[model samples]
Target: MAFYTDTIDFTARPAFSNAIRGFFTRIIAAQNRSIDVERMQDLSDAELAQMGLTRDGIVRHVYRDIYYV
Candidate 1:
């Protein structure tokens, strides 16, 4: 008996998507700074957890729709 391994690789198909491009470039770069001052000003524990983020961790994991994405 012989055992074989299967490998899967993906090649990204280029698309003219502004959102996809901006998310990686603009959003990632912008997240290096403080989170929106007014947005997280008054957040509940549930809301923060739903977003998988804490007040302190917002700017760090600051990608919009990060959980879903």
Candidate 2:
């Protein structure tokens, strides 16, 4: 399944808009973190070998997902 990482508010209320925006932001961040961790973990020994990645390399690559825009 696919999910949106953002929301829109047509209410034109500052507090309400801010709250909703913050909520979606947190959700997207969490989802992205989870995806990165899961993908890194799913790599097999041969796959990691092909990518020249060790356990530490996977951790480092996954951590870099936080900077994704």
Candidate 3:
């Protein structure tokens, strides 16, 4: 019996796929916060106060996504 397959995978990718995975990871991370950050930053002081969020809290808000799981 003689059989073969060509299933290129992460191991065969650039930087052995570490770079690719990392690039997508960063993109997802940015996506997770971009909307919230942009909307919050657009709000005035009173609006942010009503939301109980501050510019300083933006970092924590993003960090919550990374840590929650």
Clashing pairs in 3: none
Ranking by lDDT: 2, 3, 1
Best-matching candidate per lDDT: 2
Model 3, 1-69: lDDT tens digits are 998889756655667588889989999878968877777778898887787877778657656757652
lDDT of 3 at 69: 25
Q: Which residue pairs does candidate 1 place in steric collision?
A: none
Ranking by TM-score: 3, 2, 1
Task: Report residue 68 deviation for candidate 1 (angstroms).
Answer: 20
Off by over 4 Å in 2: 1-16, 19-23, 65-69
Clashes of each: 0, 0, 0
Q: TM-score of model 1 relative to the true fold?
A: 0.33
Model 1: per-residue lDDT, tens digit, 1-69? 998779644434345465589678966666643356346646887898997877777645545544433
Per-candidate local distance difference test: 0.62, 0.77, 0.75
Question: TM-score per candidate, in order?
Answer: 0.33, 0.46, 0.48
Better of 1 and 3 by TM-score: 3
